[model samples]
Target: MNAPGHVLVVGASAAGLSTAEALRRKGFGGRLTLIGAEPEPPYDRPPLSKQVLSGAWEPTRAQLRTKEVLDALDAEFLLGDPAAALDVERRSVSTASGTTVSADAVVVATGITARTLPGQSGLRGVHVVRTVADSLALRSALLKARRVVVVGDGVLGAETAATARLMGLEVCVVGPQPAPMTGQLGPFVAGHLAALHTGNGVGLRTGVLLDALLSQDGAVTGVRLSDGEEVAADVVVAAIGCSPCTDWLAGSGLDLDDGVVCDAHCRAAEGVWAVGDVARWHHQGLGRLLRLENRTNATEQALAVAGNILGEDRPYLPVPYFWSDQFDVRLQVFGVPSAENTVEVVEGDPAEGRFVVRYDGPRGPVGVLGWRMPKQARLHRAGLVDHYTQPLEPTAP
Candidate 1:
């Protein structure tokens, strides 16, 4: 394969920008264009849940790069208009603003959309924290909010709850998981998170299902649980989860499962590739299809896709990584840790609010977690490399 004459990236966030940067770094002098759904330039999202929401950092501080740096790329940026359709055979995309972009190669990096609860639309005081605007809207609502109910127990939910609590608002986290991030951190470690929230004056209402949004005069007043319990709230943040932004790619002749299904090389079609949260590609090392929603995966996978686009032909198998900051705790995770995997304390002690944990799967160490002990956890992360890189027996066709 040879480098294409022009590459069109279909999203203008971290992943899309990273791809364009990687392409130029690899000596690609071809035409490059990035299509963004939002009007603003690329910015970091992790801060939206913490620094931005908590008012510790201004919205401008979240920008990924300065204007001077972005201008150096020599790329055309089509912002404020979202991609509406894709012609896979022609390697072109149509935008919501009646503009069409064609290129020798098309990279899909549309990312994911935040999931909202039923009847949340057109309702006041309901918010999500996927973008900067969302964070600002949530912060505005929090200023007048006395009680906030966060609907989810994942990283986003816990972080939002912490932000709200620190803002002097009564906060309660509602979710089906037994503890915060139970699905990602396992029971042993998530227990500490539960304690952290409780110790911070954040209420925990787990192991329950949300039935409906209780509203009065078109403003959300509270959330009703499936077990006939209701939690009053002046503001609601639905951080349940997200789905891949593939609606525009519908009927585009590409495999679309949980995301844009791709090969080991991250190629979805003849001239099409995908990166970031919207890409569910075959991980050769893991012998399965994997899609990661974390920021680290967005940039790392984009670099791999860029190399492959420039004829490197490398498979994009990587050790998944992500981090979450709530209160004073910085939780870093390497590899995939599941609630099903058994956990063992590798270093430090949980009682001291600093420790490292190892997740053991059937084959061996699958993941390493760092709770306020980033250095120790990173050292232990070396043990997971062998398990992730080991060749596995292929399944019979």
Candidate 2:
């Protein structure tokens, strides 16, 4: 494959920026342009829910790179205009601001949009943390509110609940799982996290789904559960999952399932590639299509996509990884861990608050988890690496 003379990357966040940086490092001097929906420069979003919301770190601290470093990239950054439509054949993108960009290659890194409850749009005191403005608004609401009901028990909901509790507000988490992060961490480890949250004065109302958002006078009053329970609150945070940002790619004549479906090499079509949360690529090692939303995948996948664009011809197969920080605990997971997997403590003691656990499936160890034991967990992650590296067994017809 030959290097593209010009590459246009949509969604100028971590993935797009990393792709541009990777291209430069790989000795490609092609023309590069990054288009972003947000007006701000490329910034880190992981801290927006924690440090930025907690007021421990300023909003500017979430910037992924300093001005000097970004300037050094020597790429044209088209900020504040979101991609409205894509032309897969011509490899061009039309922005919402009426700007059309054409390139020899197009990279779709639009990422995902946070899910929100019904009637959450115009309502005051209801928040979802996806951008910097969202974090600031939620923080302001938290300071003025006495009670907050986080309507989800996933990672974002749990973290937001923890931060709210730390800020001296009464916090309660409502979700359909038995415990927080049950889907991500599995039941056994999520139970420990449940205890941690309860011990820290965070309320838990799991195993129930939200019926509706209760509001009064255009402000969120609380939320109603399907079980007919109405939890009172001055503010509400909806952290329910997210969907890929493929709305712009509609009618682009490219495959769009849950995301921009791509090949093993992250190529969507001829001279077209996809990266970050918006990419659902075939994992040759796993023998299936996979999409990851974590911060790590955003950058790592970008590097792979850049290499493939420059003719590396390598499949983008990686062991999925994600980490979360809540209260004082830092949980790290390598590979996927589901609630149905059987988990075993591999190192340290669970009672000591620092241990590593391994998740096993019918075949073998599939994931490794670190409960404040990052180094040990990383060492044990080698156990799951082979599962991704080894050739998968052929499926019977």
Give the per-residue Cα lDDT of candidate 2 at 60: 94
Estimate the overall C-alpha local distance difference test score of candidate 2: 0.92
Candidates in order have lDDT scores of 0.94, 0.92
Clashing pairs in 2: none
lDDT by residue for model 2 over 24-79, one digit each (tens)? 99998989999999999999999988999999999999999999999999999999
- Candidates in order: C-alpha RMSD to true structure: 1.1, 0.9
Clash count, predicted structure 2: 0
Residues 79-161 of candidate 1 have per-residue lDDT tens digits of 99999999998999999999999999999999999999999999999998898899999999999999999999999999999
Candidate 1 versus the native: TM-score?
Answer: 0.98
Question: Which segments of model 1 are wrong by more than 4 Å?
Answer: 395-397
